[model samples]
Target: MRIGELARLTAVSERSLRYYEEQGLLASTRTPGGHREYPPASVDRVIRIQELFAAGLNSATIAELLPCMRDVDGGPGENATPWLEQELVAQRDKLDRAIGDLERSRQVLDEVIKAATGR
Candidate 1:
């Protein structure tokens, strides 16, 4: 499939997809006309890439961890090693801290909204 098709299917922008390619988190081939050609596997790969990014993992970390990721099932696949498992633990800790921070922020916002609305 073409980049655009993959982007639409994945709900990721074409520009981000290109960026992923540049970061080596994704792989693609070029058509004879010089346009990008992605295989069907790229769909899940892109989703996995996005998930890792959402966990606050940088592109380099994501690149290193990609092979350890499983699609659809959203678990660590057989490609996982001791090193990658350690990285996952660290990333998960980061994400947990971020979630707590956001929850606190949301509670503050709720209070502000209630005070302003006199509710």
Candidate 2:
């Protein structure tokens, strides 16, 4: 499919798809006229990229992890290694801490809201 179709299917902007290519997180070939032509599987790849980004992994980390992941089921690929596992664990820990902090802030906000409403 074309870049626009991939972007629409993944609900991502064309600019982001270009950025992903530039980041080496995605791949594509050029048409005779020089337009980008992506494989159908690119849909899955883009979704996986978005999921990793949502998990707070940077582009560099995602680039490394993508090769180690299966776009279909997200299972570990042959390239998956101990060091990559360790890095993912650290990222998960960071997300956990951020979630905890956000929860505490939400609780404080709830208390303030209750006080303001005299409830």
Candidate 3:
């Protein structure tokens, strides 16, 4: 399929798909007319990429991790390793800390709102 088809199937913008290719998170072949062509499997790949991004992984990190994942379910592939597991654990911990901080900030905001409302 073409880039536009992939974009429509994945519900991602053409610009984002191009950016994914540029970031090495996605792949495509160029046609004779210089248009981008993608394999049918790119749909699942794009979904996996979105999932990783949603999990707070950066493009570079996702690039390294992609080889270790199955496109269908984002499960570990043969290339998965203990080091990768450790890296994911660290990222999860960082997210946990950020969540805690955000919760505290929200509590403070709630208290301020309560006071301002005199209730």
Candidate 4:
């Protein structure tokens, strides 16, 4: 499949595919006419990549953790704790903090509204 086709199928932007290639997260071959050709496996790879990115893992960490992502039992390596798991935990914590901040801001806004309305 071509890069555009993969992008369409995976719902990821073409620019992201190119960036992934540049970052070595993805590999592709060039046709004689200079078009990029992707193997079918790339579709699955892209899904996994996007899922990890959504979990708040950076590209560098994803690169290092890609091997573990493949292993069903979290691989045998020491670093195979599944960075995605740790990332998800961190993201949850960050989200909790954000929610608290938002709630505080909302309370302030409510007070301002009540004061302005003399309620």
Task: Name the top lDDT candidate.
Answer: 2
Q: Write the per-residue lDDT of candidate 3 for residues 1-119, one digit (tens) a residue.
A: 99989989999999999999999989999999999999988999999899999999999999988877755755557787787788888989999999999999999999999999986
Please report how far candidate 2 places residue 108 from its true position, in Å: 7.5
* Pick by TM-score: 1 or 2, better one: 2
What TM-score against the true fold does each predicted structure earn? 0.74, 0.77, 0.84, 0.68
The TM-score, computed over Cα atoms with residue i paired to residue i, of candidate 2 is 0.77
| Whole-model alpha-carbon lDDT for candidate 4 | 0.83
Tell how far residue 69 is off in model 1, in angstroms.
1.9
Per-residue error at 13 for model 1, in Å? 0.7
Q: Estimate, for each residue in 16-113, the C-alpha lDDT of model 4 and write its tens digit.
A: 99999988889999999999999997888898899888977689977866755653333354455656567657767987888999999999999999
- What does the lDDT come to for candidate 2? 0.91
Model 2 misses residue 76 by how many Å?
A: 4.5
Off by over 4 Å in 1: 73-78, 97-119
After superposition, which runs of candidate 2 have C-alpha atoms over 4 Å from their true positions? 74-76, 102-119
Q: For candidate 1, what is the lDDT? A: 0.89
How well is each residue in 7-90 modelled by candidate 1, as lDDT tens digits?
A: 999999999999999999999999999999999988988988998888788999988888876665665576867888788999
Order of models, best lDDT first? 2, 3, 1, 4
Clashes of each: 0, 0, 0, 0
